[model samples]
Target: MRKLLVTLVLILTGTAAYLWFEPEDNPDALQTDQELLPDYVAENITRTLYNEEGYRADSVTAVRLEHFELLGFTQFEQPVYTLFNEAFQPSWKASSKYAIWFPQDKIILEQQVVIESLLQNELVERIETDTLEMLFPDNRLQNNQPVYIQGKGFYIEGIGLQADLTEKTLQLVQHQKTVYRNED
Candidate 1:
């Protein structure tokens, strides 16, 4: 009984001391700080990236892009990305509802991520996922969500994928199913 009483007294005394020494925050100052937070915003942004050969490597158009000055990088809406081949032709295209891009050419596309191959004289395909991570310049695209691929006379379902857009190679990972037509 005595030990319990002593413990309670100590806790009460410590809490009282903290309350007495705590610094007070000015509500007006807090509001002003929030108001003063700087941000950079833009609409209809078109960014084109080039390769070492001075050719157009990639192009991106966004409906709205905004970033906070204090926060470095930020949120983008309706980002459509296109990649080019060595012949300076469109190789593939991608788009997403939203994305967050880092400085190192890393982009995380969220919500209704779509990728399509645009190689000439080849079977066209469309790949869909809930989320995808793309590394530019390196031309690497990966996804960790369920990926659905559809093309003429065929359909493929997979859990993940790793693709090299530079080399035009794709490797699907985990729980994959493919259906192709014979047509022979």
Candidate 2:
């Protein structure tokens, strides 16, 4: 009976010492200081912006959004942004697999970016790129990656792109090829 008690006491002491000296396995501790955690996260979020004239200027929809207020940026997954003209009519629709929006009216779209014109009269119907940078209010788009643009009867492929949505102007930095089709 004494040996049994001694054995049980030794086992209990060993367990207590192991527990006290064991390194913490906390997941939070593995995160580094450079890692910027999101302050808020939302799923299936839709955000709208209004112009000074109280007209719908733009709207953004995302499958998942993560906002880092302190970092002054928001990360989005599968984001679609719709831009409206002065008449409150949707003029362009931009979509990407991922995007990062800054507070300075700049948005960086990455991974299979597509910008499509909603206006039937627009000469440029669609633009596709691997990455793009957009400046809102000014409605300017700049991209250094390869760009593919499709118009009414012509299609253009280039290395870089600069576009002004308001002015309806598009210029390719390094034009690779242009093909025109005649319906008639």
lDDT of each: 0.85, 0.93
lDDT of candidate 2?
0.93
Candidate 1, 6-44: lDDT as tens digits? 999999999999999998998989977865554777899
lDDT of 2 at 22: 98
**Most accurate candidate by lDDT:** 2
Provide TM-scores for the models: 0.75, 0.81
State the number of backbone clashes in model 1. Answer: 0
**What lDDT score is found at residue 75 in candidate 2?**
99
**Least well predicted 10-residue stretch by lDDT in candidate 1:** 66-75
**Candidate 2 has which clashing residue pairs, if any?**
none
